[model samples]
Target: MFFVDTIELAGLGNRSYLAGGAHTAVAVDPPRDLDQVIAAAVRRGVRISHVVETHIHNDYVSGGLELARVTGAAYLVPAAADVSFERIAVHDGDRVEVDAGLALRAIATPGHTPHHTSYALEEAGAAVAVFTGGSLLLGSVGRPDLVEPRLTERLARAQHTSAHRLAEELPDETAVLPTHGFGSFCSSGQAEGDHTTIGKEKAGNPALVREVDTFVAELLAGLEDVPAYYAHMGPANAVGPARIDLTPPAVADADAIAARLAAGEWVVDLRGRVAFAEGHVAGSFNFEAEGKVATYLAWLIPWGKPVTLLAESPDQLAAAQRELVRVGIDRPAAAAVGGPASWVRDGETPVSFPRATFTDLAKHLGDDVVVLDVRRDSERAGRHIAGSVHIPIHQLHKRLDDVPAGEVWVHCASGMRAAIAASLLDAAGRAVVAIDDPFAAAVEAGLTAVPR
Candidate 1:
């Protein structure tokens, strides 16, 4: 019996699969960090025979080419995906035998991209599973706007048709595994859980249930801002992503770290929000290593800017580096794995900022305090503090000058982003108070929220 091992990219909410037969396996939609995929193949005791990409990804760097080169696997890509690379260009209804009695039949499932393809796996001529990369996700389809704005509406309609095609063609029991929409922004809207079946999606997927025009309108309207780095991903993937270098980078001393900081490079602190708030480098930004470090840092940091990482342990530093590399941030300028106390021993004490809850911020509301809401436009539009000024976390670095000089109280839906914003404001020599509580607590705190 053939089985599929799902390798999850938690930060992006994407999944890659290693489907193994008796002696061979196929890798589906791998990220640039390919070691995990290799490990899975090794565990299954199967030689990776094929590396398949559903499309030219716009969200993260793909590992297909590198993985193929390393494993001697046949690299496979969609026929319509324009790329300057060597690979088997598969079209609709193309079947390739991966192992004895195990074959992958490519189904042209466009919409996520014009060339998007899904692979339906079969064992002894019976449908076993379908790897639906972005076209058909848990309960919502992949957002079509990532490719081109002009084609967004048309592609969305295609997405609806693609979801139905898969549901109609594949057996009800066939496992439906998706590469996007666990928490990914690539999803048209929210969906539940990590996995589902074709029958389950057919019965409940919002996109499949709605008319094409209605689905397109709702999907386009619901999309949040695409990450700035996404513009680079599609191009990088098309050419071929640079090979991931996992070798531990050099550790920087205080003087070198100071030099980068002085040069206006980003010095990212990967400690927890609480630890960072207690004390951190005077000018460093706090994006907790455990949270959405990849998504937020890649979105917020200036592209091609040097970044120095400060972490509590080697594991934390390594984890942060792995996340960064997946988004085409190949290397940090320098990294140190001890807290600020160890790194900042040159007579200058680390800085600390006050962290207030929603209730606390409500109590302190006055003329001298300026509430900065650092959430997405959708979040602000949904509901927010009456007088809070909106500048999403992604735009805060460049839009810092727009904020009036006062005691800036920063917050997002939760404390993580607030802590990050607070650090940025503090680094710029502004007085900041981070509100570290859930957004739901606003009403409970007696803070007036402008309802959506």
Candidate 2:
């Protein structure tokens, strides 16, 4: 069997596959990291005979259509798949012949997306492996609402019933393989364990172990917040034919980067919001690259326009490149010469971010001080200042409605996220100010903010 996993990092979700037997193989959901999948196939000495889309992915781009086109294989999806494709659409109780005897039987399992499906592989010489995509994960079922919207209840109902159906029908010994693992918004119980058996899932998975109604209710309650970009990826995947260039971009010098910006190109500053807000190339847009870089890259960067990554140091340049490649933006033009800090050595006038140090914030902690905390939920829950209103940096766009219009002040764990949040608010016509260091400011100013 040809086995390949995309090995998505924390918060990065994807599908992986195995091509069992030398004669034919299967590509599961087609990895966004196409090179990894192609390399794995080359090692196994088998051509891909099938490309299976377990479901329409929400977080990242799908490689199924492209992989099948290159391999000359049949692309397969569930009968209910809303995606328009030129390949075979397999349904429940339908059989797809793997080899002369090996078979992949479709099982209708819809929840995360309406068209979602899983397969029970029955091969004469191989151990039974159920390809459970978001149906029965290691410790939970897939979140039901991102793609389907207000019908979270409907999807949860489908998800609850489908998980139970898989648990009851599959053999205890069947090796359960899922598309996404821990840390993915697709699954709430993503961190506890990686992979498990059908029997193990039945025993431990919270969603699968509970009764249908209870499971649905629990799924609704425990649903992790979905990324804003998730709404944009579904329709793009279903229609097929998106222009994602697989090559890394051309590197440009400092002057060339400036020229591109002058020509109206977007600059994505990967440094945290504080670093960016404190000072950045004037007219450059802010999108922090600290965590979930690839995710934000896909969301912020449009197709065809080359990306110029504003890296902190040489250390982050490689990470910046890797994140760009994950979403199929193989090429990035170049990194700023000596970091954004060193750009001034070339005699360029830098834009100063209208920001304050922690001391400045402490001194100004007057009555009606609104400290907007833009860190993630975990960070906010652990410790926060007295007047902080929590709003994670990533969801700043959607959550902007709650911010008070008058003098909205921002500060994250560090200066970075705060700057990004403040920038967005400023763009949206809000009175925004940011603190470069919130913790240090609290201590210096003698404010009664809680400490870690």
Candidate 3:
């Protein structure tokens, strides 16, 4: 019997897989953090015989090279990927024996990238599962625009063809396990559900159902702003990512924290938004340890800028470190654990801001206040508060001066982003209030107006 184990990189919103027969297994699209994959193999009592990637990932670093090295497994990468490292270059129709009764066959499924490929795991010569890296996802396919603007439409057409080829070639029962959906920005659109098969995709996936031209056109039109940090991920993966170091960084004292802040280094507080709003070091930013730390922080911060982290506990600091490293933030310059009190200089009061709901905003709607919508351009297209200034959070740091001078009330789909914007505003010496409530509440309170 063959068993497949999922390793969810929830922070980055992707999944890796480990599967094989009784003795040996193959790892698919492993994340930079190899401990989880290594531990899963140990528990299953399976030696990792192969570590493979469907493509050079653009969202997070891959641990395939290092994992294969540690386990003495063969590292497999697409033959077309222009990677610097040596590995088992996989090609379409190439099959590798994984165990006595199991084998992996590579299938070219380009679209997510020029070199993207999928692997079908066959048990006793019958295909049981296909790891469709970025090609065929639930209800959606991987976004093709990540590679280059000139090739986006071409890739989209290829994606459509690839999805159909999978459906045509595989059995209806063949499990369709994808790596890039599940809240990943790599997905072309919102993915449908938790699980799906080749049959399910054939029945419902736009890539499979729609004509090539329609699918390509729609996919191109729907592409959103690529995360700023994504420009670095592909190159980093191509060069072969260095093994990550998760050891706790040097502890930053109050003086060091203050100095770093003064020097314009980001001192990020890794606490809940509410805790951060109550009290935080002056000039520090808030990226909650529990939230999408890697996605948001990496998106907003200037690349290569030194960062100092502040967490409420040692564990919180450690957890945040792991999330940041996956996206290639590597080691933090410094980290401090404890409350705002420990981070502030002697005799200096911690900075704080008020948090309210949309109902509160409705009550205070006036010229004296500037309502800021920090959601993405796509989100703001639906509806937003009347007269609210729209500036997506990712662009906020660069466009801070463009915001009208007034007491700012910031909001997003949920409050996490609002809190992040609020902190940025607070750090910039602007009086800000974070709307720590859902956008649906804004609609309930009659505070939203359709965009003109």
lDDT of 1 at 372: 96
**CA lDDT of every candidate:** 0.89, 0.70, 0.93
Lowest summed-lDDT stretch of 10 residues in model 3? Answer: 187-196
Name model 3 segments beyond 4 Å from true: none
User: Model 1 reaches what TM-score against the true structure?
Assistant: 0.97
lDDT per residue as tens, model 1, 224-277 = 889899999999999988888877778987877778888999999999999998
TM-score of each: 0.97, 0.76, 0.99
Candidate 2 minimal-lDDT segment of 10 residues: 2-11
Model 1 score (lDDT): 0.89
Supply the TM-score for candidate 2: 0.76
> Model 2, stretches more than 4 Å misplaced?
1-11, 99-101, 125-127, 250-265, 271-290, 299-307, 311-338, 341-345, 349-371, 376-385, 397-452
**Candidate 2 vs candidate 3, TM-score winner:** 3
How much is 44 displaced in model 2, in angstroms? 2.3
Best by TM-score: 3
